[model samples]
Target: MTLPEQGPLRLLALSPFGAPFDADEPEEVHVALANGEWHGNHLHPDSADDPVNALAIIADAVQETVTACLRQVWPVCAEHGLGMHPRDANGRLSWWCAGERLRRGPAHIRAAVGALDTLMPPRRPNRRSRRAR
Candidate 1:
């Protein structure tokens, strides 16, 4: 299946409460890979109501997609070359890098959800800072 441009899959399962999975705003989501092939269950049917829940669900699915199909970590820490995980930064889901750039800072957010491509370019790390773009 081809990955959509919007986000993740939209299987649209009920939340066991009869609420609409998409409510009033239906959208298409892509099946992304670690490199960005996503498939299977989407973030969740009810995440539309709560952004935090949606972000968490999306991050989990993205991680699963990256790990299961690519056999490699997605949104890796370019500086440390280590796999990154998802964490809720405020209300948005951000990639959490486990590597520390210095003492007392072993973890940090790499980028917001779906923004890794912007943060990480096709070249050296020096050219991929969030402030650079």
Candidate 2:
């Protein structure tokens, strides 16, 4: 995803070698920025067994890393303009917005993780109407 001031943002897996004393220990996998900067706890290896759990874990890690390293919210709700958090909506992992709507309650799911682009309106080129011309 592209940030207006930061250019494009890319996330990558970073697995460093385990401690020298424990050569057999598995490497801990972390979500890192393109430049190799990351923050927060490393992803739990057990989470990899479940796709839904894995997505939730990764989303949380990404949010933590982005907020700390970039000093900004990673994904903001389009309608409410508020920062959204990763949450479990039913059985799916989704981005949850805390902003309320007219009788819509206090919170709602904006979109599934990695599907925020679907909520964004399509970009249209500027074109003057015939009347204006």
Specify the poorest-scoring 10-residue window by lDDT in model 2: 13-22
Q: Candidate 1's C-alpha lDDT?
A: 0.61
Backbone clashes, each candidate: 8, 0
List runs of model 2 lying over 4 Å from the truth.
1-23, 101-105, 121-133
If candidate 2 were superposed on the true structure by all CA atoms, what would the RMSD be? 5.2
How far is 132's C-alpha from truth in model 1 (Å)?
35
Could you give candidate 1's per-residue lDDT for residues 6-117 as a string of tens digits?
3343333343333456556544453464244555465544677997777677777766775677566665788788788878888777878877665656777888877777
* Per-residue C-alpha lDDT of model 2 across residues 50-71, encoded as one tens digit per residue: 9999999888888888899989
User: Which candidate has the top score in lDDT?
Assistant: 2
Please name the candidate that would achieve the greatest TM-score relative to the true structure: 2
Instruction: Go through the candidates in order and give each one's C-alpha lDDT.
Output: 0.61, 0.77
Residue 100 of candidate 1: its Cα lDDT?
69
* lDDT (Cα) of model 2: 0.77
Residue 4 alpha-carbon offset, candidate 1, angstroms? 15
Task: Quote the lDDT for 11 in model 2.
Answer: 54
